[model samples]
Target: MAHASSTHDPNVYFVPHSSKWPFFGSIALFVMMIGVASWLNEASWGKPVFFVGVALTLAVLFMWFGDVIRESVRGNYNRQVDVSFRMGMVWFIFSEVMFFAAFFGALFYARQFALPWLAGEGDGAATHSLLWQGFSSGWPNNGPAAVGGAFQTIPAWGLPLLNTLILLTSGSTVTAAHHALKAGHRKQLLLWLGITVLLGCVFLFFQAEEYIHAYRELNLTLGSGIYGSTFFMLTGFHGLHVTLGTIMLAIIWLRCLKGHFDRDNHFAFEAVAWYWHFVDVVWLALFLFVYVL
Candidate 1:
């Protein structure tokens, strides 16, 4: 199983195509949006139709990815394809950074500008002091700006700490797996890769449990106020990224089992590993700022 490398292989090159993937993707997105609109409007069948579109979109994604993987395994991917993949990953990660940045910006504005102004911290003191008397800037307030609810903040001691450790450990294991693959230690690579994947899954399980506890036990939700909003936005996106990274690792594991990648040329495996590690880093930042601070 020869992995794709930088070397140009003319036999494995594909001509540019006018493809239907764009149309299929657009249709799926449109249907999903319609479903969202319908659901919001209380349409009886909106949810079902939206779910159908979701299924269709997923199928399209599966077919698209399957084609790419098949082409790679069949040696139809040349250096050009590899470069395209690298560039695509770079841009994909950039877009994700921007997405997270928006949420962070919201958090910043809420903490600095909105919260303070509401607390009479600035020149708007006259306006703020008149409207929301006795209100102070803080993270979690279950009450209104005047008499906010007294909800307890989630502690960063137990579950979040454990999860942080789990993600860091998984990152290390993934690094070890990459090293093993490069060294031609197939057995070692499999063992470490399997462990890393299991860690990712376990992290997800614990995160879901945490969310359940927050909602049911502590009454913490997206509507809980600024605290809930920022908490959910940051952690929710991080969780989604973790889920995607886990899926990527699972695919890499399957390919490994099938002996699809050689030690000398496993760019796909490396790329996914890079992405997984990047996700881990982002989670670390989230854990520190969102949970601890």
Candidate 2:
């Protein structure tokens, strides 16, 4: 769509005409998913296909978001459109909540029910003798058979604590940035937002270091059984979110530099801030349950 179809009639509810990005984006994602599945199954051509799909999807997203940025900047978006975007983001975040909930639920089930049942604690009197003879129910056990030998859990008070603090600081910085935007303090907005992005980057860096420590020094990995799997899955997905949020913050920072928002009509900034806060909250839950617990 080149421009909004509705001229000046606010009642018209402007809509883009026959957008192709959605179709292309869907195809790109399908390809990416196929590649990932193939790679996981150890296909010979899987790595190249996965990389190609990743590149294609990223390109589609870049172009698609660029179009969206252009459309928003062209004043094509009305207040109604802004409302739609807000509603969409709300549901999007809700879906993300469900996604993380499933993982956390799995962790809870493993620790509370599955482990105990297998270890003959509750109702399985003869199961432990039939299965793992001397298996003891524990929080961070590597299943009954001890898959991938023994592994050490990361210390909660070390990098995890530091990362928690970094994310908490980032949460405050992003909020301050949001307030700066609403108060029309562009300079302050940029400053706080920049710091938030920096903090996010630092968090990811520390997480990488933590992962390395887990793998090389502690003998922990995704194959170290249930504990290893959950640890990486929870922290890995959270890190991916932080990376995406950081990128969005950087883009929003640029938009701020270019004066893309006003005191009242800055739903874009608000949306990212909302997402960042959601990430912050998720990290807090992860740190508590996945680490300290």
Candidate 3:
């Protein structure tokens, strides 16, 4: 219940005293992990436990962010704090880039090396002889053992393409909103940000439909060999990022309505914009590598 101290000097960097949110968040995450493990093993109580953990985690985030927003609005943040925030966001985005890079690397290695080796191409003759015989080495191979049975891939020209366009348009809308904010046009800013949020929701809807088609019609699933696994892993995580970005945009929209940001002091808006743009770029990569090529 302690509030940020109001007696701090403006020239110095402000730091809040120890907060319990991090500890609570960590505990929630641990509980969620336990629930996930239990659910995977078909424990009867896992679903409820997982839901409880998720609710607890979200509550913690809500309270924690509310505190931060209160602090920002109270002018507790200065130039040094702003610089630190910028640096933190930059490094966070960099880490996210590396995370996706790892996934892409796995895809590349599986396609260029693992699949070909399993099929006895080049120097893999001995490996093939000792292991999977008569296995085909093709793009989208179901592995030598046929781990998840045969399945058809969703075409690049279908819902995936539509979602791509939606994300691109949303990117434009968000950029326009940023420009509007900078120009002190609150009406235009709200309009464009709302459009961006709508586009994000549309993209997510299409993605869900595409997932349904993959599962029911195409027989594609998480267990559908390397192709299916990698496809879902990349797209699913990206979808989750889009969901988070959209939520952030929505929150910003509400803040804008309350006259929370001024022309020159809106790093919160900029940070969310940066994140949304990053999500767009990652989706572009996913479209090219996972769907097109």
Candidate 4:
């Protein structure tokens, strides 16, 4: 064999073997899904199974993430690894966009086609008149008057507007943190990250309060009507994404505290930033479709 190079190559991305992480992750997800489905059906042991699955999944995630962190700290990942991670994140965000698009498509279809037809428009005008006689056309609001449960529409004022501002500010804060990182201002980066996380928490708290206000005061609930269902499915999922993005940002901040990244090689932080911005965009869509319209 030819003589090997004496010096180690800094540009190579070296990753050790991880034997069972993928298998364990699959099992964890399987258990979780079984538990969720069973629990939804009121099975007796579903909750326990579900909680166990959750615990298992969390443990696996911690261990897996720990390994990655160790590898990162060891400087084993090169720019190639970072590029792969960037591509993965891009695809993941794209999938999420498509998911939200499906829901939005449903909303659009209902509004443009189904609702109009039900209101005696086009060919449906004659059929609607005979089938649902004396039924006046109006947007369904679940309350004393509507067909669904006793509920009402959530107004687009006050807390919602405040939440909009909060999320907008959060987006800015995250961007600022990214800029600080690029500038190699470590202290400023950490501070901005912390502020971004705080804003995320504040947004979550306010959203919880808003949900309570909607349920107790406005009588808006998931089971109210098509409107309520779509509203919850959109905003609720967006909120969940926000929570996840916040956790990711918090983790990145913790990594930064440990001096994990630099100006030229900070892909982890960039990935989280992309996710946060994705959450922001989804929320803007929700605000327009669910609140403004």
Best by lDDT: 3
C-alpha lDDT (0 to 100) for residue 272 of candidate 1: 88
Give the TM-scores of the predictions, in the order they appear: 0.89, 0.94, 0.94, 0.87
Candidate 4 lDDT, tens digit per residue, 1-293?
Answer: 01112243746655579658889999998999899779868899999999999889888887887887777766666656666677988999999999999999978876777766766778787867777555445554332235456666767787777888988998998899899988999999999999999989998998999889888887787767777777788888888788888888898998889888777777888888888988888888888777888
What TM value does model 4 have?
A: 0.87
Ranking by lDDT: 3, 2, 1, 4
RMSD of each: 2.9, 2.4, 2.9, 4.5
Cα deviation of 49, candidate 2, in Å: 2.7
lDDT of the candidates, in the order given: 0.81, 0.88, 0.89, 0.79
**Candidate 3, poorest ten consecutive residues by summed lDDT:** 1-10
TM-score computed on alpha carbons, candidate 1:
0.89
lDDT of 2: 0.88
Candidate that beats the other on lDDT, 1 or 4, i.e. the better one: 1
- Model 2, backbone clash pairs (residues 3+ apart or across chains), number: 0
lDDT per residue (tens digit) for residues 1-293 in model 1: 23564555655656535668778988998898899679857899899989988888877877777776776777766666667778988898888888888988888788778887778887868867678788778765433352324455678988999999999999999999999998988999999999999999999999999999988878787767788878888998799789888988888898888888887767788888878888888888787778877
Q: Candidate 3 residues 146-217, lDDT tens each?
A: 878989999999898989999999999999999999899999999999999999999999999999999999
Worst 10 residues of 2 by lDDT: 1-10
